[model samples]
Target: MLLTAPDETQVIAREPWIPRRAAVCLLICFCLTWFYTLGARTLVPSDEGRYAEIAREMAATGDFLTPHLNGIKYFGKPPLQAWATALVFSVFGLGEWQARLWTGLCGLAGIAMVYLAGSRLYGKGTGVTAALVLGSSFFWAGAAHVASYDMGLSAMLTCALCAMLIAQRPAASPRARRNWMLGYWAAMALAVLTKGLAGVVLPGMVLVLYTLVSRDWRTWRRLHIAPGLALFLAIAAPWFVLVSLANPEFPAFFFIREHVGRFTSDVHSREAPWHYFLPLLIVGITPWFGVLAQSLRHGVRVRAAGFDPGRFLVVWAVAIFVFFSLSNAKLPAYILPMFPALALLVARYLDSASPRATIVAAAPVALLGAAALVVLWFAPAWIDNAPASTPVRRGQVYWITGAAVLLALGGAAAAWLARRARTWALTVLAAAGFLAGQALMLGHESLGRDKAGVAYLAAIRSEITPQTPIYAVGQYEYALPFYLGRTLTMVHRAEDAMLLDLERRPHLWIARLDTFVATWEAQRARGIKAIAFVRPDIHADLQRRGVPMRVIGQDARRVIVTNDVTAQRP
Candidate 1:
């Protein structure tokens, strides 16, 4: 088999063996990198545990319309993510992988969508490269396995964008066009369910901006607005109507408060500088930073002829990037939707890039990875931001150090490949770095072991009777309720975890500390078995107030106590 010149196609059509081998390798790498590590770590709190528990509670209670957290109504976001997780739980039974199955699957689907989109817009080689970039990108892969709504949102948004692009193809048949348009509508509706109004708003904004720039006013006529809208409303509206009807306050809370207020004000206190996502995007793209930047730069150039998918991709990436940048609240994952478009653009750039240009681009990633390796191996002390009193284990430290070494070698190999003008080296290096980075992240789970409370919950599992009363007093470890297999009585505080749900269903929460103390004392006097999870500070205060409790488990952040009993080692 003779090597063909690297051209627009990049693939050697005369010798099909090359592409078949490449495809086989890509599939194997995808499986190992994406799916194998889904259950490597305990679910981390705030988001992972919260979403997983919501799904668990939804499955346990059989209330799909109203999302619940710790037995209270939770409306922070829409039900799509929870609904999907619940469905997974129903099938697989509750566990870490089961909770994350939907998200991981969606992430894989998003990669496939980008591959198809890139193949249609560019060539087979470009399509394969696009899939590699997306599946290997650190941020995308990180969000892919986490039990969060953002992955779902990103997948649906990609579907809508890719479907719209297919629908608008000049050579497509009428029936094909209609089906693609329907896909676009269905994806948009699912996106709305996954997140909030941003599902519809972000895609609509992107399309409108693309039309304005491309001067494709006729494209609007191709949407078939009547039936398209009907399809959208049919898929997206029934849930809103049912949820709102079931909980009247949901309308104001979900739309006005969650959507309008969250965007316009600092309601969630997730304030960040205007350029918050800039660094995140940089770090998220990881070793491919140079390629991604060049792609965006090349993508924005006005095409003289043809369909100009690059221009549309540019609009998609830039519009979404700017939209969240201008919003009052921002998070790292907020810009995930832009990545698929960016990957396609980068694939196009790589497909046509010169050897010198490729080397120049790969240099920075090598340097960056080298710097990170130095920080991890030589300056391990710099990474220890945890409390000085916290015990550091030599074994775990060495494990992290090993992961860093793997990353450094990956960087070095990538640089070597770049110098040799190996186009596929970027994918290989990225896969190595991402796989190592994931291991590093998974290893960090040791740091949060106490906070995650998986071990603590195991110790207390037998102590908890069917009717044992549990209280989260003055603190909440998001993983506790899920691990304990029961909802906690939120004692004396109903803020972040409870939110507006507290107002609607305050019975699940004791709003006054004094009332909670009195009830606890009475329960103790009556010889009722009860357990409470409280912060260390709160535990000391309770101890000072002569709260009769025996410590059953202790950690850096929390102390689990039982009301007046001979606490066995747990």
Candidate 2:
């Protein structure tokens, strides 16, 4: 019996028996791959530490509804992720792993959703393959372990889409369909809470397009829109109402600015060309890029009579992909919401695509290893111009070299196994590739440690006293507040939603650079202690102005300074 990628006929013909233990084993492997060295790296700035600090503030103030940063109103995002992190922090006592555990859990749940959806729509083989494809994808795995709202939003969207697809099936019983509809509503509501309006808008667009393209308007009747809408409102509305009532500025900042403005304008200065996510998707999928391309190509074909799941999945994936592409704001992780559908579609294709195609697909991944080898050998030359403390570690090079070798070996093994055992080949290749990629990410943590401010914070921890007012002048480091166990008073740098907070509470924020300098001088004259975080350029400028600043600590990112009187006293 010649083993080849299944065709449409072969897809229906093949009954690859996937044992119950396969799911259990997959879950175990997922935990290992996703959570490995999760806490080994310090919390990265401006996102991970920002979210963690918000959660810490929530826990400290005992306020779950209104999210605050630096003791001021922060209405940039809703409080779902902050709430979850606060809960984790409460029980786990506020650590890196605790902060990111929610995201990691969401990532795992997303992989599970794809598995179940694939199993129900195609077969167990397709289901398992889809799970592996998504669970091991470079972007998915990497995003999962970070402390961000994207993972939570992606997970909820996956649940809503997968549950909706399952509910629309002709084989679904009345009760089963109703339950699935309810689940879909709940998922969308949670998604709304996770990331403002994109949660509902993107899914709504996909559903509308799918209805028109597949000519399946009758599917709407089964959606139970009245109850579904009620459920969605029930879960998603109270937070908006409460937050708005509590902070009168919430409505304008959240809906108009965060949702509409963020999508249409380059409000955050995150502008990119339409093709930004193209290379991201290719690199994101990594070893599975070959199979994914074939699967997506096959996804357009019409199949099944009542509700075409293939077309629907394709629509779901493509709609979101194009939605972000058309948006003015572009980030690599913005396309994360589309990955689940892509995984299912890829699983469908791998069920019947050619064995030769699978082998050919593994070629790029093998080459990726060779590239890593080059990077490993040239690490020193590459980072020569970096900061004095930014030297590449031998361990990082070793890890990269090992990952490259592992990916190459996995690709080689898959190529050989594709001739006789395609399923085994894919599974082995996925596990090896995912583990190798994870190792590389873990290894790279050291490169950013200096800039992340863990060491600098430790160096200055004892110098800070309860009465000493610490100011973050000109810049903010997200990790600093969390590590210091308090917030920094902002001076001359209030951007994003922080700008709105500054408006609400002027006293908490210093708007003028000159005002901060005068205050520092006055405090030093009175024999009061004061400290500030300034950028290197700002430090140089202050020196030129003869401000008599004493640099207690410095790094590539920021310089920690004190008034000369404070330095002399302590």
Candidate 3:
């Protein structure tokens, strides 16, 4: 498409592709990246189970008044995300694949929205490039599959910022303000529902900072404060008010303990110093990390020559970083919302960029992609053992570190090759996407293979017959019950409920590395027919104790033990 500025002025920016190609690339990117995740077993540990459990409770109890964690009242977050997960579970049933549906869907929506927002703000190519980079981000992919609150938060925040950007345009009409303002409030309110006040707090702060830095305090006038406030309260307030009324402690738990308390103190997982967000931005940006730096520096150089690009890009980017840094609570994922700004900035830099800069950016991304292939090829070996002391597992981490190092080197090479050209921005984003995709395709096995709760539960369903008892020792993998479609009791001690549960029922499956030996005597004494486990340490020790726990069936990793004696202990 061709375009001219207002009054037939110079065409400041152009997108090379027609609308059709842009949409297709984005759609293809979206489908390929997360299409795998939707089908994959829940890669996350507790988050999937915790959220899925809450949804199950919501559907089962029919009382959405309070959030429940492990069957207890859990007020850690607002109900928006839980409600969405519940809707999916309601339709699809409570499995990780079904429960995580919203995350993947929202992730794709966010990718599309990025292109829309970027294309409008800059040009088509820049918009596509921004989406490409952000889509492949480390957090983006994981968040899509993890069934967590972060991805929704990212979507909400992006929509809010993009809406606000449209609202701030000089030539913005009342219609634009109303449309975008409504979107802003709606997204903010949903964000509030998803994760809590930070949805409103962070973006609000960023906008205020942007206004201050942009020397456009007057911009707030079009914010349409009256309607904005009404919309936010209308969307967000009802849930808060209702939930608070239903549970009086909701106010303290949701607002104070979670938001205020979490920020001032290390409430959940007290992380490191202000430097916490540094690696996060790096990892969260991934493959594109090098490209973004170039974008920032190049964008800055262009603006220093009396252009507004630096002010807009730098202030927006730094403001987000500073906002999170000042907050005491920090997680790598918390910085996700800041990416759209980086994307937009990168797009702008590329739009005005020389061809050389574009090529340099692509080289690093290509290198990062190739590096991910290396990780995938070796990820199986890496997942074989604990990272405690094994040389192979240690080398696996080295692989990740090495991939990262090469990615950086490639960026330097791109900068050297392209010099100060705009094409650098174009090259890097595609490369980042390619590498990120490689990891997604080949590295899925490496994530939770050794302790794969889904596979374990599946085996229990298929192999064990007639109310077989399943006990997870050493640690409770919460995902077990969700995948198994059962309520699992925890074995506080080896001799605790697991022993008793097995006694009450026949053919029990116990999973523990430390106390497998003791189970053999108990198995024989009780006339237990079989012992099923992931290791043979227990079998070895039991044999040494003169108790024969023969392994009937064994896989590459685990062994199954069965005593020849049948019936209960007499």
Candidate 4:
């Protein structure tokens, strides 16, 4: 049953593949899964715990102007996300879901913007498919559920991208163009506040690339630059002005060292190879890899006339990819802004693709699913000999098994329906991709629990009062401060302590282990209650040195100890 490609013109005019009611139902289900899973797992460290704690501190201290983590001033990024999350905490009360609410909303907003842009740029079908694709994308979905700066930044950039597309369309009225262009500028400002200059820089780079590639110089006339720049400055300037007035050192550190130094040098110790994001991008779009290849190929063919949006989107995605790839410091989520553009491109390709092409796309998904099942089958035997792996592996097996089954069955079903029911086939694949991503994230709680230190909260809380002094000696548990509703004093952790203004507040930072030991001895002599969270190896060394401490709780990562023997649990 060989099938030939249909005429491109005819395919463009065909009716939408999905019915209206079904689209609505699918959207409802997606929303349920998205928000329902926000609190299903503990907040993981590095990004999740860091951002959440910043918000928690902001709310607790009522100092929204300057962000702080573990009681020291933190100026690594702008305060927009922390401000939003702190507001959520003020109204909703503190919890995992409350901390993550803002990020979830940002993710939802990005999907909505994509749907609107896709519908207007291509058609209703393309718009719907684009939203589905973005909402289900493994990286986008996972990042959205976690408390972080990336999703908020990505969502604002998506708004800017969509607003520009809407404003520049050939059929747009003068008033509509003016309004949407303002929206584009405002989104860019929020994006700057969300992360930094990359918000505006990345988009500005795309515009330059798009103009050069598409030769659409006249498109600039529709941007309403005077008012757009005014709006942008109005929104993004005040914070910089206020923060700089309060802290003289902010301008240099934020602009010069944080942004420029980070990109040009490896000061942050996060340097990676140029190809670091390649694997991330590949896995980021899971089942959609086949469609992505098709879309990029389709995007290269220029239309004969007016605004070449396809070319613009291609440049938008490629330029951002190249920009970050060249940077000295790289993280997985640095390329998140590219996902929305890729979704739009993939949506356009799927709209006009033949059934045979759709079936081909399903093949990889099915194969990947089978491979996952095979790995899961032997996982137990492989980890059986390792004592530490047993609990975590056993807890995760059910989730991995369920995800593999969903992907396997969904791919097969989509392939079976492609010949006669194109919409249903794509919808099934998107749903499976979404659910599988959620399952994997939920399963990560097994490991996240250990890192988060939430299990030790009970014992630690029972021993301490609000006035008790807590010190993180030789290590910092990123998640513990938020759970405890207080910050820990830094001891011998120079990397984070270096960010503070040590000239005025030298006591806040402990630069040497001997200094920490002396302080502990003095506090114990004064009969002042103090607690310390120390790494296991450091705890053993301190114990061997005859430091007066009693263990209240112990975990593989850290040991919670107190100076008073009565506080220790039997």
Candidate 5:
């Protein structure tokens, strides 16, 4: 199948840029880089550590119905990803790569789906290009390597979007269309299970917008809504129903607070201005930002006779972008679901674009790379007083410098080759972008080590026994629990409602500094050994209060201490 536009189809047929063998080699290399790098870095905090720990706990306790983090009931998001990760952990022992395997596979699947969809909708060349574009796109590639809900959610949403497009194509047989529509519905169900309502809401919104924009009201007739809805509910409803039944508080918290409150208000303290995603979208697209701009512009103007897949794809990208932009809560990954559509659009645009346009597209990437180099050169001086150690800062600079150089040289080479060898030009740029992104990610391990508390792991293990009570005072190290394979006693009241119920789990929480001190004293009096991870300022305060503790490990962010003075210091 070819693009609906005759001219675009001709361009694709005339210029099959890259050789088939080379494309296969590039993809094989990508898969190696993608999977091999999963264990290359420590899991960073907030999302990576949180999700991995939840899955670890789930696997350990054999509680798949409800998710828990740090041994506390957590309903912040759905459990599909956690369930998958937990299953992985159950089969393979817990580790960095094992934790990220599910997300990585989802990311790989998204690339394959984009390739298939682009191939069917546009042409074989367009499909191959789209896969390269998505597999190397900085944000898409980076998010896949991290253990998070966004990749899983985005992958399913991409599946739904691609299935719908394929199903609604003018050339699809009735049986083929029905099967694809059912797949679309099932993908949406899995998407809803991956995140929350946005999984369903985003796609539903895109459908409405696409129908309105294309004036293709008849599109709804082909959706097989009755059977599709039945399939969707059959797949998505069981977990929500069972979990809500098991935990009475699940309904309001998961539906109302997490979905509605997170979107409509700044309750999560993640609010950003309306134009927040604009810069992210630009940078996240990386070397392809120029192509994206061209794609959107061309996609809007292109018209087709029957069902317009390009128009639908454009609407899908725009609706999702606008939906999240208007939201009170903003995150870099929140807009990820729109990327696959953008990839298809960009692939279509590249298929028809002149060599001169391709060269023009390569210019901005080169310029951005140069600009990044300049920023990195002066960044150290600008942040001379920053808390990070000089060696850490130097290492980060080196890694970024390598990435910038790759971008700069690759972009220039792609521009030089665009007219003579379009296929090679695309391959060079994609390889650079992919490697640069991996470099940036691997470089972060320098800083992620501290954030992940990996440096203190040996000290922590040596000082504490399996049954030793570990308390988190004033601050919680999200990644440490996952590393240590144990949960910490949260001394402070957790900000998340799911952390603990103060009324019911009063014994589990030490609400005040004084209370923690008293508890420490009582434990010491009973000849019990206890370990606590305390913030530096909190540690100083405890020292002033005459608390008896031996410092076992120390870092700028945290101080690990034990009540047993005989414990060896690190």
Candidate 6:
């Protein structure tokens, strides 16, 4: 075996065995990789949480077509994700977990889709390697855990491109050609549903670029226009037509504002430089990142071999990469669709690629270990001051620091394994990284970021009778209402719908931002119980106004502040 743990990537031009052992290993790794995202359960309404809320709202309101955000008709994103979440909610009943179930499933589907594309088009060995690289990829992994639209978008994009690449060929039969074109149409439709026009455009452009660079327009013969269009419309048209009809302005905003304006501006607030994805790609797809680099370097050397599998994949990867790289606004996820292309190229290169290059590349694995130890060593100083008030135990940071050390060891071990032609060791390194990172998230960081707010909301539920009107001062955590089984009104800087609700009811709870309240010092004085989800000083500052709110529960970024009603002479 010419495989090593650090570079277990297989040959891209042939088929490999579907080894049972490898299958089991991949299952376990992916299973553990996304092991616990609190089952997409209640915590806080992140961007993802908010989207889920919109879907639930739609289902409840019987407004199946139009997408709503914060109970308002929002036409920013397409209705695919919301619709998907709504379907799950309708079937399983709405909850945090149910709302995110479909997206989470999509994440898993993407991993499997990429693996199939790599294995079938390239080789089985390459397929497994690609799957490992993708699963361990930071952005991909993070997307899987969160309820954001990116995961679903990535899944669709990968499928669309992979479906097209695998099916596109010069001497394809009629059936194969029909299938490919149909795939193009179906994938394009799903992509549109997932994230609107760019889904189709990005993949379509990449395919066009690959074919043009390869000088192989003959593959266009496979496009069965009638059937393809039919399939596309069947999957995607109903929602678009209904939603557009429901809200007449959807087309203009969705296409023009979301696709065109987003590309040209930083309205989504994910703006980055022209080269943002360049470094982001490298760092986000770590360990195997060296694999993508080596693959590209090898690709440049063999560029003259026109129409070769390697060239086609490289062109596909580089074209997509450069396309997003040149864009004014970029996000780490903008490069996701490029991963499969890179993986395919790497798989091909690994078939006859140099051993020394891979081994030498594995050297960086050591740096990860050093980084972990450094962070762990000064964790007390570096770890966010967890408002938990429990003295920072060394045990708490142990998991992340330990995992860091383990990945570093993997780098060294992978180097040795590569020397011995043990490519599968690469799988081990990825598994270690995945386990470490995921464990740390669930075990520690998630406590503060994912659950603290939910916990704060949960604690005061008893105090919040049915009559209690809840107000979210800054933003609503979609998961909060779902978890608490109640909805909360949102209040901005000014007195709005939320304040009116408070005036109308007795048991009123407000998710007040400390600074916003401090600015409106009058409100801070009236607030009997302050649930501070911020710095200690903010709460301490409030004491100066004669409002004594005690912290009942604490996490890294959130604190539940409640005042003693008995002490107050009302």
lDDT of 6 by residue, 1-570 (tens): 222222222233433333689768778757754645636334344565567777778777777776654455566678788888888888888665676676677777777877877666556776777777677666567667666777777788777766665565333456775676677788779888888887778867866876777686765555666788889889988888887776566677678767787778776676777777767777666666666767876655554322344556677678778887777677766777676666666655665555564565466766777777886777776445655533334445766677777778877776777656546456666666666556554545444444436645556764556655444544444455555555554443222322323444424443355534553344445653333333445545555766545555555444445543433322
Error of 6 at 531 (Å): 11
Better of 2 and 4 by lDDT: 4
- Residue 23 of model 2 has an lDDT of 49
Stretches off by above 4 angstroms in model 3 are: 1-15, 18-26, 29-33, 297-313, 366-435, 438-442, 462-476, 489-570
Residue 99 lDDT (model 4): 83
lDDT of 5: 0.87
Whole-model Cα lDDT of every candidate shown, in order: 0.79, 0.82, 0.62, 0.86, 0.87, 0.62
Candidate 1 steric clashes: 0
lDDT (10s digit) by residue, model 5, range 144-251: 999999999999999998999889887789999999999999999999999988889988998998888879999999999999999999999999999999888889
Q: Model 3 — TM-score against the truth?
A: 0.74
Off by over 4 Å in 1: 1-19, 302-306, 380-403, 418-423, 566-570
Global Cα lDDT for candidate 4: 0.86
lDDT score of residue 421 within candidate 6: 54
Predictions ranked by lDDT, top down? Answer: 5, 4, 2, 1, 6, 3
- Write out the backbone clash pairs for model 2: 5-352, 5-353, 6-352
Candidate 6 lDDT (Cα, whole model)?
0.62
Candidates 1 and 6, the one with greater TM-score? 1
lDDT winner = 5
Could you give the C-alpha RMSD of every candidate to the true structure, in order shown? 4.0, 3.3, 7.6, 2.8, 2.4, 6.6
In order of listing, the candidates' clash counts read: 0, 3, 18, 0, 0, 13
Q: Residue 363 deviation, candidate 5, in Å?
A: 1.7
Candidate 1, RMSD to the unseen true structure: 4.0
